[model samples]
Target: MIKNIQRTLIELANIHRFVMRFYREVFMPPYEFKEIIRQCYVVGWKSLPLISLTGFITGVVFTNQSRPSLAEFGATSWLPALISIAIIRALAPLVTALIASGKVGSQIGAELGSMKVTEQIDAMEVSGTNPFKFLVVSRVLATTISIPILSFYTAAVGLFGAFLSVNQNENTSFRVYFDQVFDAVTFLDMFSLVLKAVVFGFTIGIVGCYQGYHSSKGTEGVGRAANWAVVMSMFLVFVEEILIVQIIQAMRA
Candidate 1:
């Protein structure tokens, strides 16, 4: 038990060092703008279709499930505001991050892990290249910038799905439903969404890179790195969500 705890602590310390190195390298010299843009396209644009489908389904299912309860309480009219708050404040960010952790995070880990196991990363370093900056920094920045935009897109799509459900059941007009949604959502909610998205994005990117960069030798190690990246990213995302929610609630109080 003590050995296990010590291993965990050591891993955490290594991760902290990796993150600090990233911070230092990110601002140094030749910014890989081209690589960053490419990664953004790969991470952000490639993710849109899945995000859209998931967001729409999530909104529809959540609305359908919540309707009966609200109807029972004669609060069906509050559906728009309720949906808006739920989606914007929590659901969108959480869903987006989870999906990205599974999708983008795993991809990054596997790609980098493969490069590492094959000694491609070593070759780059041996050459005049700053492999960490070119690879890790660009990908991390891509995830960080892309996720907030994706979260906003998810929230919008979710609201649209909710609107469809509400219109079918309550005959609420589009404008009226949207107006109510806007009315209920404050600056705090928007701030929370952006903050959560950015933090989650960073967590996913950093964890994936760390796992891949430090993966063991062999093909099995590549698979293990990818798996660990997804698991760790999702776990950290949940932890961050809980902490952020607590902080937000405290601010609200």
Candidate 2:
């Protein structure tokens, strides 16, 4: 078990290095700037609506579930502040990471894997086109830029949803709720959480693309890449969450 873990860690480190190298290559000569913009449109704006809707619902459900627990302790009045902190610091980014891993990560893996199996990757090379630059970097950059913005949008919608949920059993204005939320949440909290989301998004895109581009087991390889991308991204996001929390705590101290 220890050996397996060690080997896997080494493999992951190598893959991360490869992703970085490809990113640098993409920026050098004959830039594929168009693809990057297209991907941003596809990954960002197209993803916003769904992410926002889900984020709102997640906030509502989270508030509803936690509200009763706090109310049992005679702390219903604390709902807005607590919910805001929860959404801003943890829930929005974490949940969005999971959703994006499953959605965009799998899509990237499958698309790249399919292209590889079809010999299109070889064609790109034959035509003197850097496939990794045009395809992988574009998508990866899109995800990196998009996820944080989506996370912010999600946070706003989520807070709004929490506001509405609070009104279901009590009377709380949006202004009052947001004020309390901002009061409890520090700038560090925003920076840390959003930074973590950006990292998570980059990991999801790059890892997914890596797995897909390198897969070689025929049709089975494509499926494997998608599966691994989702799993790897989720695990990495969880690990990062722990590391980020520690960093935040250390910074506060």
Candidate 3:
């Protein structure tokens, strides 16, 4: 048990060093704008359909589930505001991050792990290419930039789904429902959403890269890298969510 704990601490220290190196390298030289753009397209655009479907379903199901309790208290009219607060401040960002951890995070780990095992990354190094910058920095920056926008999109889609559910039950008009949503959502809520999205994105990207870049030397290692990336990213995301929520609540109080 003690050995396992020590190994975990050592791994965490290595990760911290890796992150620090990323910061040092990211701002120092020839920017890989094209690579970053390509990664953004892959990470953001390709994930949209899944995000949209998930967000819509989540909103619909949550609204439906909550309707009964609200109806019991004759507070059914508060549905739009309630849905808006829940989705914008928490659900949209958290769900989007979790999905990305599973999808994008695993892909990144597998791709990099393959490159590592095949000596592709080493070849790039020998060829005088800054593989870390071209690959790691670009992908990390792509996730950081894409996630907040995706979170916003998720929130919008979710609200629309909630509106549909509410309209079917209460006959609320689109404009009225949206107005109520906006009215209930504050600047703090928007701030929290963006902040959470960016942090989660960074965590996912960095953890995936770290795992894959340092994967063991085997085909089996590639699979392990991808699995570890997903698991670690999700774990860190939840930890960040809890910490950020606590901080935000303290600020609000």
User: Clashes in candidate 3: how many?
Assistant: 0
Instruction: Give a tens-digit lDDT track for model 3, residues 1-253.
Output: 9999999999989998989989998998899999999999999999999999999999999999999999999999999999999999999999999999999999999999999999999999999998889889999999999999999999999998999999999999999999999999999999999999999999989988988999889999999999999999999999999999998998888
Error of 3 at 9 (Å): 2.9
Error of 2 at 140 (Å): 1.0
Residue 99, candidate 2: Cα error in Å is 0.5
lDDT of 2 by residue, 1-253 (tens): 9999999899879897987787678668877778888987887787777888899999899989998799899999899889888898998888888888988898899989999999999899899888888888888988888888888888889998988988777798777777888899999989987888899888888888898888886999999999988999999999999999899889989
Which regions in candidate 2 have their CA more than 4 angstroms from the true location?
1-16
By lDDT, the best candidate is 1
RMSD of 1: 0.8
Query: Sorted on lDDT, highest at the top, how do the candidates line up?
Result: 1, 3, 2
Question: How many pairs collide in each candidate, listed in order?
Answer: 0, 0, 0
lDDT of each: 0.96, 0.87, 0.95
Off by over 4 Å in 1: none
**1 or 3, which is superior by lDDT?**
1
